[model samples]
Target: MLSLAAESWMLYGIACVVLICRYVSRWLQLGSVSRYQIEDYIMISVFGFYTTLLVTMNIVVHYPTNLIQPKDVPNLTPELVAARIYGSKIVVIVEQTMIMTIWGCKLSLLYFYHKLTFGLVQEWAVKIVAAYTCITWLLMEVLYFLVWCRPFTEYWAVPTDNIQCTAATHHLLTNFIFNVSSDLFIMCIPLPLLIRSKLPFAKKLMLCLLFSLGIFVILCAVLNKYNSFKHYNNAMWTYWYIRETSTAVYTANVPMCWALVRRIFNLRAFNSPDRNGIAKLPETPNIDDVPATIGGGEFRKQTTTPQHIMSAE
Candidate 1:
């Protein structure tokens, strides 16, 4: 119960910080590009939705209990039946958040790709990748829920029959593999192109750093995989509360951290709260609109600075 409370509060606090940063970024017009703006909203939505659900589930799980069990006839104790029900809900929420966050990360990657690349082929690649990512993760979400819904008691307790439940474990493994692969793919996609851009090593390094937040996401996936493998057949309560919360904390924070980095660097386009020295650039064509000659090739505007990008890395 204490663990649940701590996790809930931490997630709530993170959600609040992200929200404040988002509004500040918007007010300052720090986030000027359309793609960046969309990624910001998506990040906020993912964090907000997950945290809210988790807090609510914790409330339900910890609500005042006063049920009389037949076994304890004289001295009645609070029935934990509701805890099981709510516990299952927590697992579902955790799985949902993780799946959604994976999608959010993929979208963020695609948005950066779109902003950085301009040719027709590059544009098509972005669209195709976005479509595939959304579809795959949506299917994974559906699979998770279907597994969660089988023989309701099986969710809150162990099944009497040795028969397997839905393909939840399989789905999770698939999702984990998919996410890690996607993270590596997204991280590598622009490297060769960046190398060809002929930008200074410093500039190229900065761009790579900005996209490197995906590494944290991959790390989170690894942690989740380890936790799941270590606790494959535990009681539902431990399985749902401990393992699920750990995954939620790591997965949900990825995008929030990413957004916070954008906010700190004043990269996203909203007006800064204290405009002491960082002069606000005009909201035209975005920083990515300028085409500079790199390597032997000319690339469009890549406005990200070294410091701003490296912090995220």
Candidate 2:
């Protein structure tokens, strides 16, 4: 448990730094925080929930909980049972915050995709995926609070006969399915666009790699569910929960930091011809600066600027 706490905090710290950079990149690109896009603000809110999850998970680890086997339940004192019940309640908070943090990242990515695909046929695909993501989140919440555990109090009931209430096997399964599938759907939105763009093969590959970081997030989700199912008695899934949320936060923000990166390094390779046939970077990066080759070549004749070429890379 000590090791898990340490790992969780370490990952959370890294995520914080990445998110700070993401905001700085956006601020620099857009001139001020007032000009920040919707996705940028969404991620900020998600980070708030991420912080809450980390704090709640700490409480869960340190607090007593009735996660013991049936044989051990008889041994618990009234005071100990009460403590366990309180811890069990904290567990629900952890679960809810985790879901919110992960899904919030998903929503941020969908909005970014919506911006990326705007003015192109792919915009419709982004809209459809966004709807699907939102619907899945709603259904998952319903299954969690209303369908899976009846009476709700059973979730923290001490020495309860209903294992499902405590272990939350059904909720974990449904969450895993929803989490992984939504991640896959969001990832699919950018790959084909990057592939079809007339940019250099290396740049395309690099951009695709940036978007593909979602794969790691998916892997973390799988590990989280696997451990929850296979080792529920020991509460081993907590470590992976932290890892999964941290990875999701990272994947969502890293792509947006490219503009800052380019500005810091002064990378000139992104330069392309404008209407006057002169190649240069924009004074402030914006989605409009992206080369027309991205959306099925529809923006080919558009003025070229690398300001926000891969705003959500």
List the RMSD of every prediction in angstroms.
8.8, 4.2
Show the colliding residue pairs in model 2.
285-307, 292-299
Number of backbone collisions per candidate: 17, 2
* Candidate 1 runs further than 4 Å off: 1-19, 26-37, 53-82, 146-154, 157-167, 232-285, 288-298, 301-313
Error of 2 at 212 (Å): 0.6
lDDT of 2 by residue, 1-313 (tens): 4687788899988998998888887776677788887888888799999999999997788776656788787789989988999999999999999999999999998887886776556778899889989999999899888888887888898878776688888888888888898899999998877676556656678778878999999999989898988987664777888999999999999877766786788754343454566543323234322322243132322423434233432
Highest TM-score model number? 2
Candidate that scores best on lDDT: 2
